[model samples]
Target: MASKVIQALYNDDDVLMHAVKKVRAEHHHIEEVYTPFPVHGLDKAMGLADTRIAITSFLYGCLGLTVAVVMMNYIMIEDWPQDIGGKPSFSYLENMPAFVPIMFELTVFFAAHLMVITFYLRSRMWPFKKAENPDKRTTDDHFLMEIGLHDNENELADLLWETGAVEVKVTEKES
Candidate 1:
């Protein structure tokens, strides 16, 4: 069956946030939202689950720290020991101060890069992927909310219009 949805466009994020709250309060099902910029608290308003990106970042940081420690230990102590500033490279713990900068840099680097990659993958935003937004204006200055149609399109549209939507549209979409 061809699914139907209502698209509500708002000129301001504040209006969109309010509309989301109103829609949720009335027990409407919102499919998705598109915005030109990040809207704070929109996820909470939409009742979305908390994100786990921070946990992934911490894991990536741990992996990076482990790599740095193993690589430094092998290179400085096991492979080719160096003598610098009257310090012998005998133990990683003994020369921990000198490796602090490297450890910190690698940890940050891995966390940042891996987090970006994970986000892109999770969002299905890989390279060369086609855009999925219904309106081009949503990428510029408009905020769009998509709500499922459940035999009450008119009522939903009216409510959306009352919520300060600049434009409201009902369209059939393939399930």
Candidate 2:
């Protein structure tokens, strides 16, 4: 038997939540959810775990800071030291404030760029990636509930309609 995808569209958040609750109560498997804007508490309702990107971002920021400091110190002090304005430039530890701007910039730069790249990679998003969504209307103005079905397609469709779905459609794989 092949797996099938059934999508239920809803215009109201409360209706969507109610449908999700009903679907879960019936022990049906929900594959994924798509929304145009953030829905508060929807993740909890969908039983999704919290994202740990914040921790990753912090670690990446620290790495950036370390790189900036080490590179700057090596270039200005060890590799090619230059006496500027008659001041000793052998050790930057005494005047770390001079490097604060660069450090901050690098930290922010790394955190933002790396975090975005990580997020995109983790989410399976890349350049030239074709769309995986089943319904294009869901992206514009509707909430979608993607449910996997093993059998009993008509029964599931009726349940979804009774649960206040505006429309229901079935999506089959290409192969």
Evaluated at residue 86, the lDDT of candidate 2 is 67
- Show model 1 residue runs off by greater than 4 Å: none
Alpha-carbon lDDT of model 1:
0.94
Task: Identify the leading candidate in terms of TM-score.
Answer: 1
What is the C-alpha lDDT profile of model 2 across 1-175, one tens digit per residue?
4567898899888888988888888888888887767788888888888999999999999999999999889998889988776657878885476779999999999999999999999999999999887778767888999888788789899999999999998887452
Report lDDT per candidate.
0.94, 0.87
State the TM-score for model 2: 0.87
RMSD of 2: 2.2
Indicate the worst ten consecutive residues by lDDT in candidate 2: 86-95
Candidate 2 residue runs with Cα over 4 Å from true position = 84-87
Error of 1 at 154 (Å): 2.0
Highest-lDDT candidate: 1
lDDT of 1 by residue, 1-175 (tens): 8899999999999999999999999999899999999999999999999999999999999999999999999998899999989777888788999999999999999999999999999998998999999999999999999999989988999999999999999998776
